[model samples]
Target: MIPTPAFVVDEPLLTLFAGRFEAALERHWPNSILSYSFKTNALPWLISHLRNRGVWAEVVSDHEYELALALGYPPERIVYNGPVKGRERLRAALAAGSMVNLDAKREVEWAAELGREQPDAGLAVGLRVNWDLEARVPGESATGAAGSRFGFNVENGELDAAIARLRTGGVRLAGLHMHRNSRSQSVDVYRASASLAAELIVERGLELDWVDIGGGFFGSLDDSPTFDDYVGAIRECLVGAVDPARTRLIVEPGGSLTAVPIEFHASVVDVKWVGDNRIVVTDTSRTDLDPLFRRRRPFAVDLTTASSATVPTQIVSGFTCMEDDRLLTLEDERELRVGDRLVFRNVGAYTMSYQSTFIELPPAVYVRDAAGAYTRVRERASVSDYLRGNSWLSPES
Candidate 1:
């Protein structure tokens, strides 16, 4: 039997979501790229699964870029993004015809240098556009007045200069990337971004090969916007200005594609009372599931209770020693006895990507097939497992 405190990927659910996303894109924009955001959940098994299904990789770091390559993604199939792309890797990606969206000044410089070096290589690159999404969407942006720190700022004339510099250095500006995290993930948020991309393309007369409306779309939640809702909004804004026949529409979905298909299972091990408060301690820690510990919203949970009796209040806590390592509070619910299991839903996005080895090592991960058969994809990390890469120093006797 698989142990408690394990992550289970519902394979049927994952296939359903993946098929829906791909079908939505095909219906709205036939020439579209549905790239899986690597930073969302870079588990090797997850990556291999998506890769087998023919989804391209969208990575944000040099390591992620390399990981994608090691996982059998052709450089051309990978979308290399983020500001921390190393110089050597950046040059290699450009030479290999990867979709390298230049986010850092050094990247622009490197692209320019590569342009000068390989004038005949047809070095086409994209520029990530940083516009004032807050002003347009009004409280939709996560960055608010501070604005997003990524990409080249549109308001500061930096984008204009970057464009000119790249062109002067012989690099063809082939696409525009407008990806912003939103608080609302509403149709209007995507509408505004697509509108801005269309505007920039028209105003600059940029004949681009692609227009990437970056991901943050809500996926597989109650009353959440679906893939169709997001793709339709983008197409509505860009159809007149950008040709679907010529320019490909790219979307990098991380949470939207990964969040709902996996679950975290933790079994109740102990129950205690302290000063009128009843605490339910589980075998799993918040670090294993909610690494950020910033989720204020209640998770959709299912309880396998050992009793039919009810409780007024029960503070669901994790195995960590930290006083505040609480997952959530159960109120006016069934009393959870020892051996009861709690399953947390819609936690597949950043949880696994950010899961750490703190007081305990990583837990085993299982993928449950459509027939309810469980197969272990990753074994639980032991002490020796965790120490695999570290150097051990022998003490001098």
Candidate 2:
């Protein structure tokens, strides 16, 4: 059996959802492609599963780029993203025939150099456009928002200058990319971005291969938008502006596509009360699921105990010594007992991506496959697991 605080992926559910999501997008925009966001859930198994289904790797780091290569991903199927572009990494990606999106103007300079080096390669590249659609989001301060630091500014002549630099350097500007922060809540944001991108292409005399509307859509929400809704919105913007038959539209999806399918479970280890307030300590902490309290995502609570009405008011907490370790508070008190499992859903996004040994190190993750087979993907970490790289540890110590 798997140990406590399990991060489980229903692999069967994953395949089903992925197929459904892909079909949803294809139905709307047949020319579109879904590039899996590696930064979101780069689990090798997860990557392999998606890659086998024909999803491209949308990576933002040198390490992730290398991982994609190591995992047998055809370099051509990888989209190199992110604002920080290391020279060697850029050269490697360019050499490997991966599609590279130049984020900042400095990277525009780098792209020019790469173009000069591989002048005969006829290096076709993409430019990530940073635009201010002024799409309003509640509780977000876009007023003074300088906009995200990634990509070239379209408002100023930065985008034009980058294009000129690349063209003069003999590199073909093949595509446009723009991904807003998660605060972008409307498809209108995409319409505006596409509209502006198309306008710039005409004004600057540019040509392309694919336009990547980076991922952050609210996927699988009952009342929210669906994959079709997002792709439809994108198609509306790109229909006449670009040739769907010739140019590909690449979409990188993250939490929206991958979050809801997986769930995390932490077991209760202690129970206590301070007057009318109840504190239920669990083996898990925010470290396991960082977004637990940050967002109002729904979770299931199981108080493993015989039916009783004498339970204390609930204040679920972690084992951490900090006072802020409280996970959540219940409006009504329930009979809770130690050893009960507390399951948190919609935590599949970054919980594992951001996990660290804050207090107690976690164990190997368990997976229930699509065929209903259970397997251990990783071994549980011991105390020394955290000290493997520490120089302070010695044979004597």
Candidate 3:
């Protein structure tokens, strides 16, 4: 029996991605550190693989920090980063000796307090600066660009003040962090960011151990830029700006690691003809499989069935009450049938991370080995899983 709706990860593709990343780092910044951003895909299996490859864990939350620790990543190897770090989380990171990237002025003070409490602990801290650049993706802005909520606006006094405060407070400034753009597929954009980083360091006269170019590198996909091109562009931009002997480069890659390795599969449960449209209902919903549907992002869908012929255009709908829960609307009048499977590719990054168990639990996750073998990685959640922590009972109950 086939699973109604499932997520499948291709292990071979992931291995290729890991190798490409390591090779890129070695070629560009030989002494640099590559950290995997946990917010992208925090699966333990993926995290363990990154750890095994000597990749550090870049965490944005306490849960991610704990998850990294659970994956056997040493505290020193993890960089704690985020806009909101609760007191307890901050203390834990400091006590664990993880490098904390201070997002705000208050974070600097908090780190100072932690340092004072544990004088011998000696915490290393960095600052996140705003770059004020726009990204290639629609509706996704750059972190370093103006009006971004993340990072300190260097145009303003924020960056200068933060640096001065740390310098006078005797705090160890370890690095500079910037996540300028989400879709950093274009080499020009990445080079611009690198130039900006170099300019900021030189203008501020700040001594830094590392310069963190936060991950936005596009992964390998037919529609996306190649990994080599993206890495080469970054290398070109930083070639003369950063001293290879003095400063170590750091990158936190997220999407580039898992995008091409995962694919979503859903089985058609029902088929109907309405007016001039053919609607195919699937077991998966926008909430369960592709949350990008909610944002009106078009995903490429391919039909996987026994028939080798192409069919008419059809509209794909989910088994949900919401009218917005649509996977795709085939404009070519493609025909679809029950029991047929639809495959959504390049959805490895934000789809599962943003998936919700609303109306139904998320689908199971399967792993495909190099030999074309499939195994269940995550089991399908039952209705009980959703009601576990809920106190509200239905009237029928």
Candidate 4:
């Protein structure tokens, strides 16, 4: 039997979502590339599977870039993006024909240096444009007025300055990247972003090889904007500016692709009453469910082999010593008893990628096949596993 505090991935569901995304892109914009965001969930198995399925890797760090390469993602197929990409790796990616988007000032300097060093190499790079999302969609941005810390601010002269630097350095920009984070994840977000890209391309008279709209769209959710909705909105905005025949559209999806197919299963270990509150302790911790501790609501959970009796209120707490480790409170639901398994759903994104070892190590993860058979992908970590890279003093010392 699979132990509690383990994760199970629904392989069929993942495959379905992948196919749906590809089809949506094909339907709305045939000349488009779908790159899976690696920072969202960089499980090697998951990345390799997506790589095999013709999905490119969109990485934000040098480690993720190398991970993609290690997993057989060709340099050209990988999208290198982020504000703090190492200079050596950036140069390597650019030389190897990867799509490197210049975000920070240091990156522009590196790009310029490479352009001067290899003047005949045709160093093509993309510029990440930062704009005010609040102007287009009020109150839709996560950081309303402060704006995102990523990309070059276009409202100011930073973006123009970066462009001029690249042009003077004899480097040709291949495309423009306009990826923004939004609070609403609405279709209007993509529409506004694409419109900005279109306006910039027209105003600057840029002949681009590709136009990346970036990724923050809602995926596979009821009453939420679908992939078709997002792609259609973007295409509408860019159709007049860039020809679909020459300029390829690109999207980097992270949570939208991985959120629904995985679940976290934890078993109830003990139940106790303190004063007027009933506390049920489990093997899982908040570190497993919400590593950022951002969720104010309870996780979407399913109880297995639970008692039929209803409870007015019971606090579902984690095994950690931290008092705030309480996950959620069950209200008027089936009474949870010892050995009852609680499966948390829609937790595929950021949970595993951002998880850290604290009181307990990371749990094992299994992938469920179409036949409903579970195969362990990652074993439960042990002390020895955690101590793999650390140096210890000898007993004699």
TM-score of 2: 0.91
RMSD per candidate (Å) reads 1.9, 2.6, 3.6, 1.8
For residues 1-397, write the lDDT of model 2, one tens digit per residue. 4567777788877776677668867887777778899888887878887899998899998889989989989998999988877888888788888989988777778878878877888887898887764543433323335566768887787877888899877889888987876454566666666677667666766667888888777766475567777778777777777787777888888877678777676788887778888788988887777734465543555445554665436888888887887777776555677876677777778777776777778646767876766687766688777778776778654
Residue lDDT tens for model 1, 153-196 = 89899999999999888999999999999997998999999999
What is the C-alpha local distance difference test score of candidate 4? 0.89
In candidate 3 the C-alpha lDDT for residue 271 amounts to: 86
lDDT of 3 at 364: 85
Each prediction's TM-score versus the true structure: 0.97, 0.91, 0.89, 0.97
Candidate 3 structure quality by residue, lDDT tens digits, 1-397: 3476888888889888878888877886788778888888776677887798788999998788889988899998998888878778887777777877888767877777766666666566888987566642333464333457877878778887877776555577778886665543576667777778778877766667787878888787455566566667767776666676678777888988887898888889998888877888998887865565644467777787675544466789999999877788876544677898898887788777776867777788888899999988788878877677665676444
Span of ten consecutive residues with least summed lDDT in model 2: 135-144
Candidate models: Cα lDDT each: 0.90, 0.76, 0.77, 0.89
